[model samples]
Target: MIKVDPDFITFEGIFAMLLSIKSKTSCGPDNIPNVFLRRYAESLARFLVEIFRSSLSQGIVPKDWLIARVVPVFKKGDNAIVTNYRPISLTVSCCKLMEHIISNYILNFLDERNILSPFQHGFRKGLSTTTQLITSIHSFSAVIDKSGQTDVVFIDFSKAFDRISHSKLIFKLNLLGLPSTIVNWIKSYLHSRVQFVDINGSHSDFLPVNSGVPQGSVLGPLLS
Candidate 1:
């Protein structure tokens, strides 16, 4: 698995993408399209790989990867209602392929002064930090409120790791305008190489586990 910085995936790139889309298209929070945001996030992750690949290929490993021991930490924080998990091994190769396509082709097209590269420098850094600050403040405010009126809920799904329906996922991919060839490749890849370890020490091997696919994967959240 190609480990990366969890912060990079969660806040940095995501916040930047949100701000960019909002500014360019005037899609405010109330008007933002969920599907569009999903695609944007996937694209942003791919762009990040390009920024790091030159260094990676030169034998300069990413420090985050070395420290984390996983591609990125996929967490369901206090606000999360559910969680999912997929083996890192199954999706890393596909994510790399997706990154290559975005960096070499999509990014190049954007750079031609026609397409817009979503990696708009200062915005990412600024928005990322702002998001962290806002989240921290909100959490603190919730705790300090004199009234115990704040409410929180968490939902956990059973067999979440093994519940994906490949056909449904493929349909969603088609809706997202991904080419059939790429979609097919993803389906085959997911179906052919996943191994799972259960809580009871039992092990199973199959196409990517259906239920608990990794939410952090570039494609997983999009498909979900």
Candidate 2:
């Protein structure tokens, strides 16, 4: 479990976060590559810790972190169709480290309080679609053995991730009784974010992202 300090960001935590970043991953609009951070983790740790501590205290993140570079990836079907493409956003590497720290703290808090439902299998460690399927099959088999009918329904919604409401997500987090500081920081992180599409060597104008968490964000799954 990750130890939460709530008020300060530790150098060790920041260093670990920097070292954990994959070197091959693409950088965001800031162009501060992951390899750059990972290779210089030792020298950068203290600086990042101070920045993160200030950010947490102010409930604000650096504006550069709010900018994302979006790459459209084809997901089967017709590639020419816009709906068949999903955006993959790359955000500032250092900001992602801070996000990871905050996410771990939040996850630890939720786990200790049993805030998440047992039925939730996605975006959770040691659980996935396979586990959910096995659980469902066991229930169905038991019902069938008792000479009873069983019914199953599977639903897949398109653009599900892109449709999440920021306001509703914040409301739900508040309802879960998360700390006001964390909630406010998350609000600052989500709102006023901007992304620009990058295709080949060309880049589009940055547009304000008013809804949905960035596709490749550390906090995206949890917020969703």
Candidate 3:
């Protein structure tokens, strides 16, 4: 006689399905997986734009029209603890994705608006400052003589997460053509309840009703 747990059936079914799919004929780069990836990227971009709009609606515009200017204030020490600090750690792959989205937004914004001159001054200054900072700490040259006197600029958004509008995010998700099932999954995953234990061994349960996506989860970055 064999004993089987109900959980085994679910796990084995999923595993068998995945194995069958893998064993089938190879789908080239232009297959369903690639299509899904592109769709996800588009959805993520829409989500980010919604976040930016929400921030603006809440009167949380960029302070200096520069992203580098919005630096975290941290003490220069090993044991220094900054209260309420949530450091974002991104892999090189994630950084590249962010860069792509920001570059697209800048180009689109410039194309739509003829207000480049006014924005160029701060942008150039911010770029120079950023280049200097990057080069000063790293062993690299700060100045780049690319093209003929081309100016660089940077735009930073301040208090980005603090200003994220949950409702607007849902609207953007819908606008991006994400299925309701997926949207509901995201909302439930982000809004799940959690129990926390304090330093004094006191436990409290709380639900993040209006929080954006969690930053530190294994699948969080991929979903974002």
Measured by lDDT, the strongest candidate is 2
Q: Which is better, 2 or 3, measured by lDDT? A: 2
Give TM-scores for every candidate, taking all chains together and pairing residue i with residue i: 0.33, 0.90, 0.34
> What C-alpha lDDT values do all the predictions have?
0.41, 0.83, 0.36
Ranking by lDDT: 2, 1, 3
Candidate 2: tens digits of C-alpha lDDT, residues 47-125: 8778887787777878888998899988899888987888998888777888887788778778889988998887777
Candidate 2 off by > 4 Å: 1-5, 144-148
lDDT minimum window of 10 residues, candidate 2: 1-10
RMSD of 3: 17.8
Select the stronger candidate by TM-score from 2 and 3. Answer: 2
Best by TM-score: 2
Candidate 3 lDDT over 7-40, as tens digits, reads: 2123333223333332233222112343333445
Query: Which segments of model 3 are wrong by more than 4 Å?
Result: 1-84, 87-146, 154-162, 195-209, 222-224
- Give the count of colliding residue pairs in each prediction: 13, 0, 4
The candidates, ranked best first by TM-score, are: 2, 3, 1
Q: Report residue 33 deviation for candidate 2 (angstroms).
A: 2.3
In angstroms, how far off is 100's CA in candidate 3?
Answer: 21
